[model samples]
Target: MSNEDQYGGGVGSGYGEVGGTGQTRTRLPDAPSDPYGTPRRAPRASRGLVTVVGVVVLLIAAIAFANQSSDSPRTPADQTPPAATSTSATGTRPVDGKNGAIPKGFAHDEQGAQSAAANYAVALVSADILKPQMRRQIVRQVFVADKVSELEARLDQAYGKTFLDQAGLDANGNAAQGLTYISRTVPVGTKAAKNSESTTTVDVWCTGVFGTAGVGSTNPVSNDWFTMTLTLRWAENDWKVESFAQKDGPAPVHTDRTASTAEEIAKAATEFGGFTYAR
Candidate 1:
């Protein structure tokens, strides 16, 4: 998506503070001093003052102790199972891959959930899927059986002829000579929206580079930030994507790394094969 599409919008009137009405109330007269006013010796005021001071000190100490405990790092043993592991944190058991390549089992713990989300996001946006055969394999491996056909058809339609041409790829999806096609997604973090013993909904925030890098190519590598939210179901003892959606950015400040020449960028893309990510 273009930058304008990603962030352009108007401010709303709600941004301003609301005005408050001014009102005042008269103070009530002090209660008449105790009726048994037989010169009741100021009820030992110093003793009450001491008690109040002591209570305040105890409260401060208690607050400090609580803060210290909160700040301390919790070990695995100290943590509950769900909070300790991503798979468990997500509350979904890992599934066994139907074949190789598809994630068959994921841990029902935090770490496992994060790993699953990261790996799945990588696979979803990789350049490997541009190849016809590989694309089918990927869809089958990543999606549930019921979703496979629909996702495949949708993806095929989305990555149509015009899209391929704009990306500097041929009709069959191969990059033109001297050009390199790049479609890489790296997850910065994963967050769980809802997790349970059998299901997990996670959003993976990612940064990626896409398009072609080559001299005189219309398309050039550009950076993008997006969040891919995946809803996973536990089946066959593993987690599989039930559904997914993408939205742009929780983007960070851009770095100062100098942009490389097209030739250098193209060469790097050619030399470096992409990885299958894990958290």
Candidate 2:
């Protein structure tokens, strides 16, 4: 925490030997001596030297121990823990199948809630929602059992025959001649503001292409961005949409690229497939 040289000879006789003779003679004014003649004071310097050497060895050992500790790998207790990266990719795959055309059966977690919200956003804005037949199917597929009746009535009034006629669709929701009506949404991202075992609230940012894409089309294809917020419930062992609403975006500034021809736009919409989004 934080070694010694010995003097070879002991203090011998304080008397000097008479030269060339085997006689020991005591010189006058001789060095001090005890009755026992112990050499106590002479060894005092050598003991002090040994004490200093031992202290120096201890100091060196302490320094070496500190250096070793600093160079060694740190244990888990020595480091700060990482934070949860919620906005990052979750690595969980999205739901694979759809109930007819609408997405169904999401996971019972935050990611699942987000997936359900995003797919619901796409379904609600689709052209199919304008037709009575397809709209009924969409309501049944996307909304929960408790919400279906009320939502069906509200949606029916919202997309009534008058609105369909104004948009160049017949009562059966068929487009006018030489026109292919388009209303498709693509989700940019999803966020879960509140999540629990029974309920979840998610928001989906989306960019949608709406109107018609064909020759002599009065309502030309155009893009708009918006955000859809959905309240979801955990039921039937999966996430199901309970309620949803939309607001105008969070949209990016428009680019000045030349618009594609109606034929090209129609062809592209037909060829390009939509994605199954994950968090």
Candidate 3:
């Protein structure tokens, strides 16, 4: 299927001052000697003095608190920004096995979603997807149960006889004997959005090469740029496509570099290996 291009404190003190005069001191006679006399006890501290001491203690405590705050370790949110996760490879490893040739067992996290989306993009745009048996296998492997039958029917219609003829493939979706047909997508980057434990939507931005490569081939290999978005569900400990779509691009301007010969392009496409992408 050409499904390739969809869219202050104060203390107070009182002091008595005594002055000496030249006059002789006079003592008044006691009014009457009392049988019993009790001296008044000294007064407790004044309210102002107590208030000033309380303020000083509080100031000391506040200063100590400020110091401790400065020395405390920062929480995760306060550390240096997590090293640019987008476009940069992450530490999480890709799945170790395959379901036939398809990657199996992606991590059940955002990174897993991204990896699944990327690998699925490669498979979807690959030449194998054009063949009926492989296409059926791919649909069943990548898509969820609810979507498999519908997607299978739609894809079969899309890759029908007419499309095969235009692509120079035979009724069985095979390129003629001498020419090498190439349809491969390499993911440049991937993004995950609306990711939760059970569901995520991932976008894979890709650059692909398509068409047959040979001296007399009518369809010379050409480059296309597109983005594929896959909505995934976490099922049986792996991320599986619930649905997906393709759109034209966030493509860059064409470069002025010289193009390679058809033979070289075909050889490279066959020889080079693809990747198992992570977030």
Candidate 4:
């Protein structure tokens, strides 16, 4: 690794023929390195352009990431998200028990009000309403305490001996030998017109049979349609009627089906019991 060994090849590369004692060597200006021999790098301006484009791409990606991260947080323009569970689900206690044959306790909501209205409508027009004791029981059970006395008096006055006679019933409100009294109500649907925490107004659409059935019957049982509107108050963990009123004929056109025989009507009335709604 002598300096001469390292430098000799380089020095020899500059020499011409060395035979004559007076030989002269020419070192031409190292023929300017061929500009096209080795691979050329991109021009400075083009390299700068590539760098600028890469920087712009990075900024766009960074801005997109920021927007995606903020998506879950609501802005003023965003609507409120729905709750995972409903608030109405609470304070809901179904009428699992009954007060005698009728459901007594009800939920503290619109459904409860509708149910109470429907049941009350049925009781108000039932055959039992003709019996004073049963009528009293119904008034006490269905109406608010403040309204019970007034409603009972009105009902008693309405179902007097004269009305009973016209209805094909005796003084005791009973149909005579070989006849069956039919006064049954069926609620088709109920709607809550207004509802609040303590009070609700509801409409009960009902269909009923309200005449005597059986052979030699003076009053053949027939269908009647009516709507009963009841304003109810939430009381003693149940719904009770504060006021009630009834109107006739939002009835449908009469069905084309032939009327049933008196015997069949009487049999069906006795065999099929009324239903209590669950809300």
Lowest summed lDDT over 10 consecutive residues: which window, candidate 1? 20-29
Order the numbered candidates by TM-score, best leading: 3, 2, 4, 1
Please provide TM-scores, in order, for all candidate models, with all chains considered together. Answer: 0.62, 0.68, 0.69, 0.65
The top-ranked prediction according to lDDT is 3
For candidate 3, write residues 65-157 as lDDT tens digits: 111111122122333443474668888888989998889899888888898878876665566765788878876887677766765564455
> How does candidate 4 score on lDDT?
0.46
RMSD of each: 25.1, 42.5, 38.5, 47.0
Top candidate on TM-score is 3
Higher-scoring candidate on lDDT, 3 or 4:
3
**lDDT of each residue in 1-279, candidate 2, tens digit only:** 000000100000110100000000000001112010000001112224443233222222221111111112212232344346856778988787778876677887888888887776666555665567886787677766776676556445434464454455688667887787665567788877677999987766766565456776545555655454556788777777664433345778777888788898888878888766677
Structural RMSD, model 1: 25.1
RMSD of 2: 42.5
Question: Against the unseen true structure, what C-alpha lDDT does each candidate score?
Answer: 0.43, 0.48, 0.50, 0.46
Model 1 steric clash total: 25
Rank by lDDT, descending? 3, 2, 4, 1
Better of 1 and 2 by TM-score: 2
Residue-level lDDT tens digits of model 4 in 176-258 = 88998666667777766667999887766666664456776544555645454556788888998665433343678775787
Candidate number that wins on TM-score, 1 or 3:
3
Clashing pairs in 4: none
Better of 2 and 3 by TM-score: 3
